[model samples]
Target chain A: MIEIKGLVVRYKTVEFKFDDYKFKKNMISIISGRNGTGKTTLLKSLSSLIEYEGNIKVNGEITYNSQEPILFNRSTYENIVYPLRIRNLDLNLYKEKIDKYTRVLSIDHLLNENALKLSSGEKMKVSIIRSIIFNPDIVLLDEPTTHLDLESIVELTTLIKELKNELTFIIVSHNSSFVEELKDEEYRLGGNHVYS
Target chain B: MIIESTMKAVELLFSFDSEIYTIIFLSLAISLLATATASFFGTILGILISISDFKLKRFTKKIVFTFMGIPPVVMGLVVLLLITGPFDGMNLLFTKSAMYIAQTLLVLPIIVGNIIISSEKTQKKILETATTLGANKYHKITLLIKEIKPFILMSVILGFSRALSEVGAVMLVGGNIKNDTRVMTTYIALNNSMGEYSMSIAMGIILLLIAFVLHTLLARFRGDFYD
Candidate 1:
């Protein structure tokens, strides 16, 4: 479960005001807004990427994947293993889970290839797989399906649905259909809300 | 006359004279060492400057940016005076160590400035993601460093090229001592004074070749970076 109360963000000439909100455990919440409406900024602020004034009470760990996928020069396998390594989990313990996710994402073949050489769709898949490998309490994804093809997008939506039982998913996207397919609740920002 | 001089320069290079090789080797070694040290430290400082919110951060960046345009001769003169006057007891003036110090100072600003630009460009997103993930300060820094590895490598190469080709500051500090402080640029100067035009031209060609090799390596690395 997560609770965000009175979040305020100010970035050079722009201000974002987020009111108190609560997210239920193991539920998918989608935030929909047009471009320049502070959707990405709000998502990042929720992820703790931006400095904001708020009280975010998260019961467990949170994992965040950015809108633009970030990949190192290493192979896909190594990229997926980064967070696991940071958490100090034994690699052998998660080998089966990693293998399953890679195969499900159709990235098993690209595991040995340098991640920087992958296409945008492939990189996004890898980034998503990396974010969820360790089963964090909450997972924040910003436009994860933007670069994906129709088939890949469907597959990802299915995967998110399957994993929703174990993790809270907060997604920020402009694709309303995709959000409708996954989220039980939705919120739209940037229409007459300001903080005094 | 030009053709004859060029031919003689080629001959001197092929001959591999001990004095000429010594100068070439020393220049490459010292410049590479200085660049390596400066780039390592400068990248860390640049990342710190990019991420941290502090008073004087803007002023510090402005000072470093201004230092990037310092003339090599003026930088040389400053180091020379400092070593010979205020800290004269150390007697670093006209020494290889003094040359290293000057070259380090000359290239540090470039390294720091390049890294600052690169770090600022990418650090915001990485920091945001890491923070949202509840990553501590150490994790944030490590992840950021990984993200900017390619730019950091570029900065190091730039610093290396700048230090390797420098002549004025090194000449002022090293004093072009035979068999000791003589580096490629200073040796070229010495050979010219002795009317060994062939030797000077040979060293110049070698310097050009080294520069070419350095750039080629950097280009290859950049290709890998983008891939």
Candidate 2:
């Protein structure tokens, strides 16, 4: 569960004030707004990536996947396993679990390929998988489906739905159909106000 | 006289003249060692300044950037006073050690300035991503170092060139002692003053070659950065 109160984020001369709300645990919440609506800024503030005037109470560890997924100049496998390595988790023990995810996502064939050379959609898939592999308590996805193909989008939402029973997902997307299929709650932002 | 000196310089270079080689060896050895020492500490200083946010952050950066343009002669005079007055019993005055210290001072700012710029450009992006992935401060620093390594290498080459071509500071403390603290630059100065045009011109060629190699290495590192 995550709770926010009196949240104000400012960039240069513009400021955004977010509604005070509590996000339920183990649910997918969609945050939808038109272009240039500070959707990404809100997500980043939640992740503690930017400065904000607010109080946030989070249940557990948080992970943020940016709109454009970042891939290193290494193999796809390494990119997926980076978070685990950072946490000093044993790779061999989790090999089977990682393999299962890769197989399900149809990324097993790309395991040894250079992640930096992969197409945008492929890189986004790898990035999304990497973000959740370590089981963050709250996962923030900003425009996640922007570069993903239809099939990859389906797989992503399916994976999120299956995992939502144990994880809290805060997603920002312009894809209405995808949101309609997966969102448990809608948080709409526009005209300097938040509508829940 | 210029054509005669050129012929003599070519002949001396091919024959590996002992006096010239000794001077060359000392100059290269001192400059390389000084650059290495400066690089070690300067890298830490630069990274700290880049990643940290403090009240004096802007002022500290300003100081470092200003130091990058410090006159070598000014540095030499300060060091000379320190060695002869405060460090009297150390007997460091008029020695290669003094020359090394002076050169290190000259190059440290170059390394630090370059690193600060490189770190500022790269640290934010890498830190944002690393922190989201649960990386600690040490891990983020390592990542920062890896991404800015090409810039560091370029700074080192730049420092080396500056140290190699340095004459004022080394001359002040080294005293240009023959076959002892004498380096290529001081030696060139000495021969030129004594009308030993051939020897001075030969040393000039060696200095130019050193500069050329440093520039080439810098270009190569720049290419690596872009790639």
Best by DockQ: 2
Best prediction by lDDT: 2
lDDT of 1 at A15: 78
Q: Which stretches of candidate 1 lie over 4 Å from their true place?
A: A11-14, A33-37, A188-190, A194-196, B193-195
Instruction: Report the Cα interface RMSD of each model, rounded to 1 decimal.
Output: 2.5, 1.3
Candidate 1 docking band? medium
Those runs of model 2 whose alpha carbons end farther than 4 Å from true positions after fitting are: A71-75, A100-122, A149-152, A193-196, B1-3
The stretch of ten residues in a row with the least summed lDDT in candidate 2 chain B is B121-130
Compute DockQ for each candidate against the true complex: 0.50, 0.61
TM-score, model 2 to reference: 0.91
- Model 1 CA lDDT for position B119: 89
